[model samples]
Target: MAHCQFRLVNGPPQRYIADGVAWVLDPAVGGGGALRNLGIHGVDAALSLATGKLGLKSVSIANRIHPGPVEDHALLVLEDEAGALFIVEAGYTFASMRPGGDFEWRIVSANATLIDHGDHVICATLDDAAIVDLPVELPATRYRLFMRDTLDRLARKAPPPVSIEDYVAAMSLIDAAYQKAGP
Candidate 1:
């Protein structure tokens, strides 16, 4: 069971927990936090990213009001002086730096879909599919460490390193592994 907990330092204090850490979809409560701000625009984009189709009929947070389908969605939140921070409580499988931690593990999924969120951008996709069937026993800490490493690596470069071919290759392996492992 991949376990993950998300906490926003500056924004409203909101937390969410999930399994597997891929597609981080933890329920949200009313607040100004990242999850809450995942308003209609963001939600629509997420749905599109997940299903790979546009024209989302409607979207609601906890079954609220859904006006209509949206054209685009982006789930990123950038602060004035905070640089760039991607609010990814969904569609991810990794943890990040902590107050006290020496060693780290990298377990980030390579798959992702880009979404243009007007001002910023958001990527929504499954974590690397490799761990699909590894086992529920895998520690959540592993995912946290993976996320930490991914973000740290991102911070070190002017333009992050990404290869669609590599991502596709990794995802294919994950798919094959899952097919063989699943019943």
Candidate 2:
């Protein structure tokens, strides 16, 4: 059996993130605070790519930067049924050196290791390596894509890229992780 590892990280406390936190930093209302709000998406994507269908074996979490009502930094460690490891580090507290988003995703497989750094994706193998930039046409505005897909579906059009059921499953994982983290 072969295992693939995926990791995604983006952080360093930018104003846009802080501004957006105003709308989503509630622990009472949501299942989690910073980890759930900022980290769930990356977890979802990494899990999906790591396992076609998640056979989640176990989950654990470590929380940091808990200033007030909610945490500002969290580390999530998960195991798939196949025993592949998945770790997601999410935070809103940091001093950034770069001006742009600090986003990065890496996929490590037996044959190759691929990395996505917003503008480009790089693939490296024992034999060769290459980097291909993402087309400007395809931006990372997931909200807009979701809205458009929902509208299209409602209009009796194509099926949505992801269904609500998928979201529920992802949230379940986040919920389980938080549960294990405890109060």
Candidate 3:
């Protein structure tokens, strides 16, 4: 992909402790907020789609909606070695506690542009204005599918789909963004 944009937003967790601390908002408890919790997936996807290694370009973090020690929203811009750009946005600032909140993944290339708006996908040609709506049949419980795949791989003595190195690399990118947006 020449360019990719990803976003995930949701309202803050409804449940709070007796002390009025939402676990996700507690630094000690959650380790980090939206960026670490939700945005890492975007980072991983961006990295996978990138033509080459990605480097952080810019970062912005905020806790305006739910002021606390942790940020409720984050935006990250990354550039790949091949000059591709990736933008990632994650937040816990949506107004509702809906299950999936709002999610979108848009990718642009020389030939076409693909946009996935959680429920459906749209593809548009770059040369022409031709657009097509793609159906999405996502499982209600994806964890079951994940587990099945993982177990099957283990039975065959194969490595997991997502390796430890991938996790570390993603986390390192997130850490870099946090460091760049230092207190």
Candidate 4:
């Protein structure tokens, strides 16, 4: 029901890791690179929404990096138990920021299809196929939303948005990806 693409910004100070970054996107410093780090979230959302369960019927991952360890580009083709497909493309090799980078997620169900196509979020119907673009501004700062949600949840004595089980499920998928990313 859902698929998304994430584009990693490759700039001077933000791109590389010499002393620091906002948060290290490197495998050596941050434990996981783009595939295992960024790709997991999209995968989790897709699978969670499609099946309401973390278990995937099948998962195939491919690494498209250079002659090195880090995976700068990766694709995950996943199928849920209900026979829904979730294609996740995560990469750091996005060419430029001109006209905005390609970063979005979409979910298509029997009745309606919801899409966040970087510039706007739209809802399409299956019956009439009418598209209704929503007037919603995507957050500029990524951490701000996470922090606010976490604080609010803590104050309300509610569980975190992402739980330990979610982490486990995501890691399992990553592990499967590594195992299948053959030598």
Best candidate (score: TM-score):
3
lDDT of 1: 0.28
Residue lDDT tens for model 3, 11-118: 774434433766766778777889988899899998888877899999999988887778889999999999999999998888887656788889999999999877
Alpha-carbon runs more than 4 Å astray in model 2 = 1-23, 52-66, 96-100, 127-156
Model 3: per-residue Cα lDDT at residue 67: 77
lDDT per residue (tens digit) for residues 1-183 in model 4: 444333332322234455446354555666555667667767777646666554433443434433244666667767666667777666555665333345677777788877776568899897996989887555354567788889999999999877888888877887777667654
lDDT of each: 0.28, 0.59, 0.85, 0.62
Estimate the lDDT of model 3: 0.85
Clashes per candidate, residues 3 or more apart or on different chains = 11, 0, 0, 0
**Model 3, residue 139: what's the lDDT?**
31
Candidate 3 lDDT at 12 equals 72
Listed in order, each prediction's TM-score against the native is 0.22, 0.72, 0.88, 0.77
lDDT score of residue 140 within candidate 3: 38
Error of 2 at 159 (Å): 2.2
- The worst-scoring run of ten residues by lDDT in candidate 1 lies at 63-72
- lDDT score for residue 123 of model 2: 72
Highest lDDT against the true fold, candidate? 3
Give the least accurate 10-residue stretch of model 3, judged by summed lDDT.
13-22
User: By TM-score, how accurate is candidate 4?
Assistant: 0.77
Q: List the residue pairs that clash in candidate 2.
A: none
